[model samples]
Target: MKHLSDEQLVFHHYQVSDDGHSVEAHLAGCEACRARYQALQDVLSAIPVTPVPERSADYGRQVWQRLQPRLDECVVPFWRRLFERPSLPSLPRWWLAPAMTALVLAAFLVGLFWSRSRAQDTLASRLRQELRQELVADFQSALNRSQERSSNALAALEARLANDSKAEARQLVQALHDMLGRARAEDRQMLLAMFRNWEEDNAAAYVTLRQDLEELASLTDKEMRRARSILVELAAQTPPPDPPFRINK
Candidate 1:
């Protein structure tokens, strides 16, 4: 009779609980398999189960008492928070759009409000007064750099959205989702509404793409030819996702 391997013995030990017929048959006919199984049993038996110590009732009561005051002070119940919100003024029908537009403009202004201060800083003014003054030009150049950076960011976003890889596309979408999730609730809703418009426009733009391809192909210019060549290269490489909005169930 052939002796079992250590792996076989370990497996046999596991199956022993369920009545291993092969383990019994091998052990009956072979000394080595039985010795291996015994070693497995000894190894397994040495492992220990540790039990958690229980606290006395007095200790648990003290912990609860300590937490109770903190919980009372810090955590208002959901119902209280819901009812405690200041009652908003009854808004006019036209208030929502104007309010959002104002908020966005205000935020934009707040973000860039330091540009004028920086340009007119006492040190900056003194240095510039001694030198040539092209503060307006400096502002224009700064603005141009900002515009370029913004355009580059948008182009990168567009390229990622157009990319073929599902992982990259999902990552791009998830980044937007996470950013919108962290925004203020009212701001988030306005942003979502804005995004819905962009999505609609994108859907419409794809249709316009198919139509414009024929128009683009028919155009008479070297630039138009180059555009068609690039478009054709893109279209040939990857067809858009079927049921484009269906990202998986």
Candidate 2:
């Protein structure tokens, strides 16, 4: 058999009943259970209870009398209290649609203005970019043209300088040739003049020898013929004068 629980004994000691009568029957038959219930009753009886005080019928009147002066001192006017609470007045059913329509119209207007401003900004930025691109292209084209002109000018200057240098070189060579030809002609003329002086001196000596030979007729005729032949060979050996030198400029 199951023993009675302490909760059942506690409820019984308080004169409170539960859903079953098993605890009362067990207390009557079991001495241990009955003694436990008696001990629980004794402990509950030993604790003291604080009693609630009763008020007289005039308690509310007394409290109202004491708080009335303070309430009056802190009281606000009707208009001041109305503003502090800030309650909205009731609106007619017809007002709802118009209020919502006004709110939506204001939002649409703001969106349209914002979109227009954004589009204007985008168009301005595009125009500025196009202008900048055109300016850059123009500058690049001008620079290319300027560079071409400078290159052409430099090429012409180089060609002119080359032609002048060639002309100067030709002139210098011609002058050198003329100088060489003149020196050769002068050397030839000096050689011819030296041979002529030698011829004259030999002729005078031969005349004196002939006179002496006439005086001394003891020489043989064969020796005289040999001497005359030698003199004729010497005169034939003299060279002619050179021609004048001419150089084309």
Off by over 4 Å in 1: 16-19, 49-249
lDDT of 2 by residue, 1-249 (tens): 677788887777767867447777888889998888888888999998788799999999999999999789768798888769666965689998999999999999999999999999999999999999999999999999999999999999999989898898999999999999999999999999999999999999999998888867756576688899998897799776566876769
Q: Provide the clashing-pair count of each candidate structure.
A: 0, 0
Q: Please provide, for model 1 over 1-249, each residue's C-alpha lDDT reduced to its tens digit, 9 standing for 90 to 100.
A: 566777767766667434468668879888776777787889977988587899886997899999999688777678888789676746578988999999999988977777767766977879878666677778889999999999999999888867757887788899989877777677978999999999999999999998898777666466777989999999999978678365665
Q: lDDT of model 1 at residue 124?
A: 85
Question: What is the Å distance of residue 100 in model 2 from its true position?
Answer: 3.3
Cα error, residue 158 of model 2, in Å, equals 1.5
